[model samples]
Target chain A: MRKLSKVITIFVMVFLSVALSFAQGSGDKLGDQSKLIKTLNKPLTFVFIPKVIHPWYDVVKEGALAAAEEFKKMGITVNIKFDAPTNADISEQMKKIEANISARPDGLAIAALDPATNTRLINDAIKAKLNVITFDTDAPNSNRPLYVGHSKDFQDGYDLGEYLAKLINYKGKVGILSGSLTAPNHVGRVKGFKEAIAKYPGISIVFDRPDNDDLQKAVELTENALQANSDLVGIFGCNASNPIGAARAVKAAGKTGKVHIVGMDDLPETLQLIKEGVIDATKAQRQWEIGYWAVKYLVAMNQNHTIPAVHETGSRLITKNDL
Target chain B: MKKFIKTKEMSMFIALAILCLIMTVSTSTFMTPYNIGIIARQISFIAIVAIGQTIVLLTGGIDLSVGSIAGLSGILCSLLMTKMHVDTLSIIFISLVLGIILGCVNGILIGRLKLNAFIVTLAMGEIYGGLILVITRGYPILDLPESFAFLGQGMIGLVPVPVIFMLVITVVIAYILENTPFGRNIYAVGGNSVAAKLAGIKVENVTLYVYMLSGMFASFSGLLLTSRMNAGQPTIGSSWVMPSVTAAIIGGTSLSGGEGTIIGTIIGAAFMGVLANGIVLLNISSYWERVITGAVVIIAVVIDLLRKIRSQKE
Candidate 1:
């Protein structure tokens, strides 16, 4: 019984330690460089809140956190609070926004899960006299001071179309493993994909499977699509997970030579898959740039400085050859 | 009540038969051996978990943590094999054991403390999910050996290992549910917990064992999935919860507890798998799959409800 008690106690302690450890992050002494950033016109605090605690946000978080320290000497205090909800809940995010507002930060850097769900909260934050800048997923028309992420969703989408068109030499039946049709970003990319493919007379979108932004579902859906259409020319994943799914499914189905695939985002898995000749190419979204620009935009907004109203972090087309 | 209860379980079988007839006429590929293999492999994970879950449901409990436990164990196994330099088989075995431990935890709180199983498993699910993120730092372990990969990708005489796992688990669970005294105890406990206590059933032990079994099944899927991907991502099994629950319910397992079957759940999973396979074979969009799945789940339940009503009227 004593041994049981001892073991239980150890388990609890270990579990707590692991949970608490994540909350710490790399909070290292940014104070060392705080003075160099003291040139700010006023004391400002910018907060970057993510939709979830997934590894995808790690780069963006580092950007905002580092920028906070960089601009701290200029009387800027970047308060990075990212205790995102359990499953990327939009309602929980709104509550967090309220809490951030309660903290009365000067500027906010947030990547919205659903623009429609969070628009009112962001608008309310704007009315509360806080500066808002979107990163990754944007909430446009929310009266944010500026947008500071990817320049054009079209470029990302077009890259896949262009790469695949060139691969099949623009002459075959290609399919699209599209993402959530309702998501504006996904919708915009598909539009761009269609526009790009239209330039190639022979390349037609015979099959477009909008996969609701799930990888395994994409795989299953893509697998069946491939089986149904063995004579298909190529495939384009309209989202990050979509491409990875397409690639994996294509590989699993042993259709590597039959279909050329590409998609957007540089998810590590996607990158490795590209290296493995699964994905033909992926349009890289520089996460560090999104973070860097979000902080830069927030810092500028807090100081009442007018920079370019629109900022694009720029994108790179990555292919197997590049890898 | 007994007649109504029996019909709810068989409704999906009817649905499956109807879908097969329609699919055979509509798509030539639907009846192929390869497609059948794909269909079996596709539903194996859900089938495996649902079989175990049906047992738990028979004892008047629910386990919301199965998906989380699968994901957690998958990442844990990969991390053990890759980062900690543990032997691959040992890592897989330990991960499965951890899943059982998680289930046991759920059983202890729900059975011994007499807390609501729904609330306890839900909270435990969240806790298990958090541990997954914390342990992996949100990155997949990419370097699983070729043998592990082969386990996920390889097949024995055209049958995927996962499907075999599903079939084996189903048979074992069927034996336990039908041939064992514990099986009898399950229906008794779920039929009426108060009576079960008076009739000398070890209620807590049964409850605990059922959940542990659920975890073990989930762990099997997790290991298979990690091997298939040759990596372990934190989000590996997020889409599994609904399918697992739907399979159990559609298989004629009563959510209210006291009656269910392992074979029935397996068939239900295969039925759902065929539907998903049909959708893909026909080239339906992936996003629509969700809407369709939700609709199918609702229709299955409604049909089950109707079957019960008809039997009751009889």
Candidate 2:
């Protein structure tokens, strides 16, 4: 009986090790796909669709326009058509995507609003022989060639959380002002923050609220949160507006340096706050990089060059010192 | 005393007191001096805007363009200050004048041309909102002068400067609504426009003035908010329109016309502020806050309706 049990334990250990190795191998394969070299000297047009006409997407446009300029310098005409819906409505986004698909651009980049609907639209575009890639917000289930943007929103939040935990000495009450509860990116950030803070046993989250991406609403919510938890030591602003809002509230309550603020995005107001020492830090997503790479990768894919499945334009943690 | 107790403003006051009582019981921080100050400063902006909304409601018209006017005025003022090197006082004056001009355009269309108030203002709102986007291109104008911050972030003996402005504006507007012949004309015009016209009130002029006042109030709030934020944000007044209307309605201002007070509107604004503050103090889920706020607005309106029906029967 002892000999049989030993054989079974050895077999089980071997199976588990093999499975782990296979998982790692697959991860590497997805991340490190070798680029297939191709050169195509021709004029091309690409359509880029974002979720909404926001300032954030404006930065993305800048990056894309820069890439187009770069191609122009190389004597290749890369016409980038940047179209976006005025509102973040799923149906409107779908309509825009359908219109673009029918137009049949050489390459298409989309920030998916609704994953299921967008996946179907992306598949239709694929059927039309248009090379499609996702940016900013991805429709992973679709037949898109690649995703190029800040893919790790969770990591952005987790890193900020860890930085904030360290700032507060890993102990005290904290508050999270998540922008838009329904947004997948905001939700992922909030989850990451909660998970990161949970690792520190002494840290407790006393307040969690959604500001709906409104600056004034964020200010009101943060003020209320500060009032509710007088002993609160830190705040995590899960979007651009929230950190500036939190900084204002902390300044108003005369708790400026007493409460640490770690937030996402480096809007001008946010950077100003950081410079003034009102905000501790912020994680600015590489928006320009997302736009730059989406254009480059789309051009490459159109030329039949193989690129990595995901291109994560990482974020930068901006502190007062960094400014 | 009996007559006071029967007033809509009085009822709103009582409701507000009960809400405060509940909040105080539920949380130690609700009644704190610090929280009160915060609530006061926060409510002052909407309350000021609601004052004009109350007047517009009294005149049987709505100004959906107030929010857009606010946003545009703020952007214009910030541009003047930062780009053109305009002085602080001149910046304020210019923005307010610009607001009046915007309001005048709406008035000329709705009052003189006799267009539908809802459609005219809604379209005007879209135009103004679009202009804000076009002007700023989704960027916030920053680096406002330091001296200008006092209007928003300053305090006098623990009362925020904005609160003082709110109270002063409330008193003046309340007096105008309750005492003067112009005030009587507003009530008369709102009660019955044909009757008011026969009674020798220039209905168009009154309409024009009310909208102008609404625009001025909105611009004032925009200025204060920009000062507070230390930047001119394009998204500043996008959320103000619904709340301005909600505050007036909650204060027992009749939507049809001729039935609300500035004091009542103030109380309505305060009620909203307290409810929002209390939600956080009570640690309620953020998702439930909107649900509660909507229910409260409905309840307040229903109470007003029930009172009207009871009085009619009596």
Best by lDDT: 2
Query: What lDDT score belongs to each candidate, Candidate 1 first?
Result: 0.75, 0.84
Candidate 1, A89-132: lDDT as tens digits? 44335434554554556677777666644565678678877787
Fnat values, candidates in order: 0.00, 0.00
Task: Return the TM-score for each candidate structure.
Answer: 0.51, 0.53
Which stretches of candidate 1 lie above 4 Å from their native place?
A: A1-323, B1-11
Model 1 per-residue lDDT at A13: 99
After TM-score superposition, what is the CA distance of residue B104 in candidate 1 from its true location, in Å?
1.2
True contacts kept of 1: 0.00
Task: Report chain A TM-scores, every model.
Answer: 0.77, 0.84
In angstroms, how far off is B56's CA in candidate 2?
0.7
Give the per-residue Cα lDDT of candidate 1 at A259: 84
**Candidate 2 per-residue lDDT over residues B259-294, each given as its tens digit:** 889988999999988887665555443346568879
Candidate 1, residues B1-314, lDDT tens digits: the string is 65533654455666688898898888765677656765676678678778777888888888888888888988888877777777766776887788789788988898789899899988998999888867865455666766676566579998988888777877887897888898999999999988999998899988988889888878778788777555676666656777788888777788888867887788788887777666544544333555787887777778767876876898
Model 2, total clashes: 0
